[model samples]
Target: MAKYSDEFKLMIVKEYLGGPLGYSLLSRKYGIPDGSIIKKWVNAYKAFGKEGLSKKRSKKVYTVQFKLNVLNFMKQTGASYQETAIEFQMNEPSLIAKWNITFIKEGIEGLKEKTKGRPSMSGKRKPKQSKQEKVISREEQLEHENELLRLENAYLKKLKAFQDNPNAYLEKHKQRWHLNSKKKDLN
Candidate 1:
């Protein structure tokens, strides 16, 4: 959606709190598509007063371990995304939902923070590596090989699990599949 100004959000929230009209009525009056948007505004206003309704100036970066902990907490407690976000003092519940989806699709690797924006440009090109520098050390070669093997093993395990219970796999990830299908349809 539509982005609402902090002033407008505070007005709507105050109207919600002070007036007889409920979420649906206030939403309809303001031309908002969903009453839930107003409900979230009210909840955020209650939790953090005026500050919660304000736009975030900068995106907060979360570590991989912190992301894992958030996911674990939700899984263990069976908390809804909004509840978990509130518990963690996060303004956006959708961020947690995205994290969960990423984790499901690509495992832990997906949770790693990606480099954003355009790559840096340099006017000068770097010198080519010498033959000695280009050659991989035996230990490094073995380590690379081992890592590849580990990735292959994990992939095979997941493949086997999906093969063994395709229905269960589809059931578990039906939402993601549905979203993908919708995108395809749009295309």
Candidate 2:
């Protein structure tokens, strides 16, 4: 469900357009938490009219190609997410931001449409491994134990150092308090 009704959004947009009050002032007047929402509504109204203020009931699915195009346009023009969304005629600018993030993290494959709802369960299950296959070699086990012991030895050495002279240890390690003290001294 939409938080603000279409009529309410239109009213706000009209108020912003007709009055001298800016986005921040109007947002405060309407008890809105963020002024940017009013700015978005006004921009949407100016670009697409009252229809832009109306909440879309159906979710619009964009093709991967379309997603790539929008991203490319943004990159080429150096436009903000909101401006890119307006150029693409997409109501949600956050969707473009999400696409940008996903593209950066996972490349183009991330923009592909994902299946909705719970995934179907496969009928086939993997065969259990034999006990011999599951068992680790004696040499590998010894190596793992040695690595663990080395970590424990290092930890104990650090603990003893800290116990012996906590102030020296903290100062040498540049601990939070030490850094803060340096900052205070500089100030």
Candidate 3:
């Protein structure tokens, strides 16, 4: 882990931004550790000018509401990570990217910064569903399965009939397809 001074980072980032050759060439020419660092620095510079490439301050935890607001704004304007970072006064644009990913994956609840590692099971909680609800759900599932089975049976019977009389089935299907296509054209 190498620490790049603000001046050194600004120099490299400026050089990269000024020229066409990207991080790979910059890394080769300057021997500045990883190419990815240059890429990140370039992105930071593009997103937040001089302030973005500076050494980050002490980590400040953001509230869930703030995160939600940031995401909402991003959604409304169709903003990119860098744009959102600039608008929200964030150092690293990747933070907004992470927030968006978390929101899309686990929803608003995911915006909350939870304790890292295994969650404690010590808190007592009520069961999510009671017996009556469970029974109704089971019944609904069974009904769905029964309906599917009936449809499958019907399909198989029709398929067998078609197989037994291919010419007749084909003629009937051609007529049906023409009728459906004509109806679509009229609509």
Candidate 4:
């Protein structure tokens, strides 16, 4: 629960290594709650010298090659995750355990750590598109053509009226046509 400094841990480990007293006695004498932790520290000190007995670090960034090496060593020596973690001076024991699990499931390639955090959305999104198909019956097409012809007739009549008298078309109709033409120009 509490983090001890590297110097304090090294001193405790040195005391335990120097004396012949058992872990329980040493733990009672040193006021350390768990004797098993001292045993782990001793193992760590033996395997990695002073570095293994140091305080825990943040989530370590281990390379794929390093993970593969650890996995291979574990396989060759048949060492447990905890033992391998202590020997390798990993931040946490579960790190090696998870690596072993990944290695077993996905082989050496699995050891490569994936990028962390949420992925960006820009690359995943696509612009909206229209997919509707138009289908007009023969009768409907003829009716549309007839409507256009009627509109043409109306336009001719209006043109004739406007030629005869400039004010034949209403001011509102002229404004509407000017607005429609401006909209067409924009497109």
Candidate 5:
């Protein structure tokens, strides 16, 4: 579909408001395919006056009041963007982008429009730990295991000496000993 400028739209609305031009003449004048649009604009002007035609027919912008309402809903209810959008019958993506920025800088009050084209709400997280990271993690685990084994070996040697010679075991020793003698069969 083609987009028309607001000026072009206002011209069409003006023509419609002026008099009956039938569907064919109106279609030719505006280069719009359907007569229905002209009829609708006429009806809208009749019911709503010039205010109806003033709005640019495109992606709608939320008013500041509306944005504040949405923000208040978010802060008070702690609703997710999806929930707030759904509750208010708003565009989820647009509402979410606004909600995020609002929460970031000015808290709830900042939900009002800054400039449009804020980035998407859900973006991909950074690439998870690379293969190199995984390999290093495994290496660290192995080193830890080796250290544990060294400590265990030293403990067992001291315990064995204590059991072998009780008198020597009673003398003051630099290192305290722990014996896990349940594994005696392994020795």
Candidate 6:
């Protein structure tokens, strides 16, 4: 697959340097699957500034079948990434990891080879939280308590609803109807 834009890579590198946006957040924010890449970018920026954030060297080949076969073998074997990499005679785990991440984010199509007519970015990076910052606001704290109350209310409501009209709930939802379907077939 192709690499990220220089601008996007610089943006993520800047975010990483600003504190609290660790590799995980950078990965999530930039849609990058590898934490090591973020770390590399951060280091590159420290060493060379914006110029260091340049997209790394890449060698693209028409390997759709190779990638798809790797994906299929991975799914069928449920093997660890390293195992699959070794089996496929791949030199880098990065490609396999990228495929897996793509699969998770999108679907089977993610495993397909990068064609000539694909979009560059699926999404952009999100603003990151700082490490020293508070994890939640007063509004969030209140919401957590409110959610508990709502859950309790829901349970009580369900109990009352069921007690008040069992047949009504059953007839409306029809969860119990499945068990009786076989009985009807026997007759």
**Top-TM-score candidate index:** 1
> What alpha-carbon RMSD in Å does predicted model 1 have with respect to the real structure?
25.6
Residue-level lDDT tens digits of model 4 in 91-154: 3566788888988899878887788889776776765554334677889889989999999999
- Clash pairs, candidate 4, are none
CA RMSD (A), model 2: 19.0
Order of quality (lDDT): 1, 2, 3, 4, 6, 5
Put down candidate 3 lDDT per residue, 46-152, tens digits, no spaces. 87788888877798899999999998998999987777877887877778889889889999899887888996787787668875566557688899899999999
Total backbone clashes of candidate 2, pairs 3 or more residues apart or in separate chains: 0
For model 6, how does the per-residue alpha-carbon lDDT over 6-63 read when each residue is reduced to its tens digit? 8888888777777787998778776788787777666656656776566446775626
Worst 10 residues of 5 by lDDT: 174-183
Tens-digit lDDT track of model 2 for 96-174: 9999999999999999999999967888777789866888989998998999999999999999999999999988888
Model 1 lDDT per residue over 5-75, tens place: 99999999999999999999999999999999999888888888899899799989999998999999999
Best by lDDT: 1
RMSD of each: 25.6, 19.0, 18.4, 8.7, 16.2, 26.9
List ranges where model 2 is wrong by over 4 Å. 121-187
- 3 or 6: which has the higher lDDT? 3
Write down the worst ten-residue block by lDDT for model 4. Answer: 125-134
**What range of 10 consecutive residues in model 6 has the weakest lDDT sum?**
55-64
Which residue segments of model 3 deviate by more than 4 Å?
1-3, 17-23, 32-39, 46-49, 116-187
What TM-score does model 1 achieve against the real structure? 0.64
- State every prediction's TM-score relative to the real structure: 0.64, 0.63, 0.51, 0.53, 0.31, 0.29
Q: Candidate 2 — which pairs collide?
A: none
Instruction: Kindly report the root-mean-square deviation of model 4 from the true structure over all alpha carbons.
Output: 8.7
